[model samples]
Target: MKEKDGISECPEQQVILYVEKEDGKYEAMQTGSYISANYLDDYFLKRGTLEKALGEKIARGEINAIEYYMILEDLTISELAARAGIMKWTVRRHLKPGNFSNISESALKKYSIVFNITVKEIVTRQSGNRN
Candidate 1:
């Protein structure tokens, strides 16, 4: 949208939007949330519940880092595989703790890139872990 035509969502929430300059380069612009405050609050509440439940599962070792990050990022197995440059089946395998042991260092690095985390963090991070 044009700068003047930008939407006003939540006055309290700030978001980043890219606007095209006259020179054709996109620039970062600060904008409001896409949704209203009440909707954003509801979304945050639901996401918080999901995070808490997922964190508990992770703490119980029911799911590993790959699955945790993938779920939090809202990525499908196919999307994750493509982002990490792995096969769909391989991504699925690594989602479990047992099969994660078979993954290589290079693959770990790729996951780190995809998750925007460190390899050490992936292996050692606990539930509710955030930087």
Candidate 2:
């Protein structure tokens, strides 16, 4: 029986796959795959939980909009700063709620590109935080 490009070897099995660069063309190429639903589920759950916490922090005058952007992008402070083309210290400073009002539109634009979201979304994420 023939299998589809993204399908597993059997219906009973599921996997996350990547194309392996073998010597053959499309149909003959093999996939490097793994089964890790538990891992993926746990990771997504942690992200959701963390986002909820971050939202509360934003509401409570602890962290700022930067924390939301960073969580959504799954980026570290250094990575976010790098993507924004700014200093890490700048990013750190922006993480505080007190400094958010002073953030420039240009800087928000940079973060918008990194997070693949619009500046409006960054500034005012709605409840449930769905993008």
Candidate 3:
């Protein structure tokens, strides 16, 4: 993933601060500054965790690759279908664990292309439980 230089702020950003006067009284002051969040690492960490969990689930046969892509990969059924060049119903059907083993090699290839992984890797690589 490409690194971003923090968040971009809109032109009308504003902030308020309290100022202490000579009499020890507080006064309100308005200032304009850009606020940015440096959470890219945290975001990637959480996404990695989710990917691991999804891989484990797929390995355990608790969920199929379709479900893993839909949940962990954050893709909608229609989007996945379009990427795979298949119908949404076909994608939904493949989401069933029982139907996963019946997926055609061509369809598997399409899914591998969409996920940017090899067919063998997608089928065999299992991120087993850590413990």
Best by TM-score: 1
Q: Model 1 over residues 30-113: C-alpha lDDT tens digits?
A: 878777644877888989998777777777778776787889899999999999999998888888855666889999999999
Error of 1 at 37 (Å): 2.7
Q: Which candidate number would show the highest lDDT if scored against the true structure? A: 1
Across 15-130, the per-residue lDDT of candidate 2 in tens digits comes to: 54444334343344343332442255676788889888878777777677778768767799999898889899998888877787688999888878888888888778632332
Model 3 Cα lDDT, one tens digit per residue, 2-93: 11222233345655556565566776655543342335567688999998887787767788765776676678889999999999998888
What TM-score does each of the candidates earn?
A: 0.66, 0.63, 0.61
Clashes of 1: 0
How are the candidates ranked when ordered by TM-score, highest leading?
A: 1, 2, 3
- RMSD (CA, Å), candidate 2 to true, equals 6.8
Q: Sort by lDDT, best first.
A: 1, 3, 2
| lDDT, model 3, position 119 | 78
Q: C-alpha displacement of 108 in model 1, angstroms?
A: 1.3
